[model samples]
Target: MPADVPGSRSERTEGAARPGGVASAPEGGPSQAVDSVLDALDPDRDRPANVIETHGLGLSFGSKPVLSSIDMQFGRGTITALIGPTGSGKSTFLRSLNRMNDKVVGFRHEGDATLDGRSIWDPGTDLLDLRRRVGMLFQRPNPFPMSIRDNVVAGVRAHRIAKGKQLDVVAEQRLRKVGLWDAVKDRLHDTPFRLSGGQQQLLCLARALAVGPDVLLLDEPTSSLDPISTEYIEAMLAELVPALTLIVVTHNLGQARRVSHRTMFFYDGQLVEQGPTEDLFERPTNLQTERYVMGRFG
Candidate 1:
């Protein structure tokens, strides 16, 4: 395996201590994870210059606030990991990016969240288009009750984006992107249940990628998969970050340390701290963040 590859098991911090040990932090060089992401970033590609900005973004469900005063900027094409204990509003914050929270009754928010400088809450904002641009993958693999090919191309087909050969090409490309095409190429017509648990999750990712999203919001996307499957998805994500901004919510501090370029810690509906992943994990500025990262509690 390449030394610079994200999730490269061989690439460990100096003194090579894996996260969660009581070992002291390594210093004097870029941490392994950040080095990998930086190496993977393309210098020649025309990346998104626009930022995803959230200002005073607070959300409440029937008078119960879940996210409060979140002012942050996630740069284009960066991989950001959201971490904290359960009920810290990580998932709620992710959903708000694409307005998924509107489904809840009495859900209201303050301030603004924007993708590429466009306000997502604008009355005239096309909800469908917004969602398509900011695609989401949930905790568990939720493949539709359909053939593999159909599931992969569902969104594009529904939006009338392509047909016949073009649709077929799209399906093949996305499946291949997620490294599932070879395994399922001959079984495209088979139902999703025919796939193993990992394959199904990769299929869901293909479904999301088929539509050409600008940002991929993953909510613990590998939580339900086996170790090997988790590895496959993490590798794919590392590859995808160069093309799209990725915001992932994962409670596994080790996973966050391994894969994210930046990390954000949330607690009781407020963002306590955020910065380069290594700094946040190895030397958290906030006491709460330090405790959480150290696995003291959640």
Candidate 2:
């Protein structure tokens, strides 16, 4: 399940987890240069395509299995929501998308997960590149103990993507994308801890966006915020989908229906159903899905 988002629980299942680390460039200098990462964020890049796909995927930690025979697809510049009861492996599935489970002890998997048809599990895969293409935000906003400007440019600098004025431009553009630049523009040099929880979460979002990911993964991003903050995030997400793919794990079914173009329901480590958001909510093919969506059971 999730680590910091209180009340946003996850079932232990058989396996799960991942934390980020800097990865050396592949045979080449870097998978993407500073300018390329920045260019990815341009609003014009928004378009529909199958950006992520999983086939016959299965995962286990030690001997316990958390996911099995799962097949799913995520479209570029679209939003898809994963919903299920506690311990059903929602977070586990999300983590696997970016190999986040690599940090978990005894974690292993079978089957294929691809980004643009390239296997993510390949030994030659560039971890940093994968992360840049697929950025993630946790349930709560965990800002680095640094100034807002530094927080936004952390990834960019780590990868040596940009410098000087260009770096400043990246910071400003991402902050604006998340609607935090205007609020924090004057205080860009101030520490992030000084911001309210809502602002901090948005800051975290800006940090993720600074790298310009092709697919964005959020694990209950709004679960810890106040209603007003939640509204802000949801609105921002709507605006973002036109440029990057978004896969969100949320417990709030209402929120799922409100924000997703496609809805997926999981149970006991398996995907029970998935379809267009309206069709799934209005007419689920599976009884469990219907019951869950109807508030009959989680």
Best by lDDT: 1
Give per-model CA RMSD: 7.5, 11.6
User: How high is the CA lDDT of each candidate model?
Assistant: 0.83, 0.82
- TM-score per model over all chains: 0.86, 0.83
Instruction: List residue ranges in candidate 2 displaced over 4 A.
Output: 1-48
Per-residue C-alpha lDDT of model 1 across residues 9-102, encoded as one tens digit per residue: 2232211122122124345466656544543563423433545889999999997999998998887666789998999999999989999999
Q: Write the per-residue lDDT of candidate 2 for residues 16-59, one digit (tens) a residue.
A: 11001112334543565743564465443443247899998999
Clashing pairs in 2: 11-87, 18-100
In candidate 1, stretches whose alpha carbon ends up further than 4 angstroms from where it belongs are: 1-50
Quote model 2's TM-score.
0.83
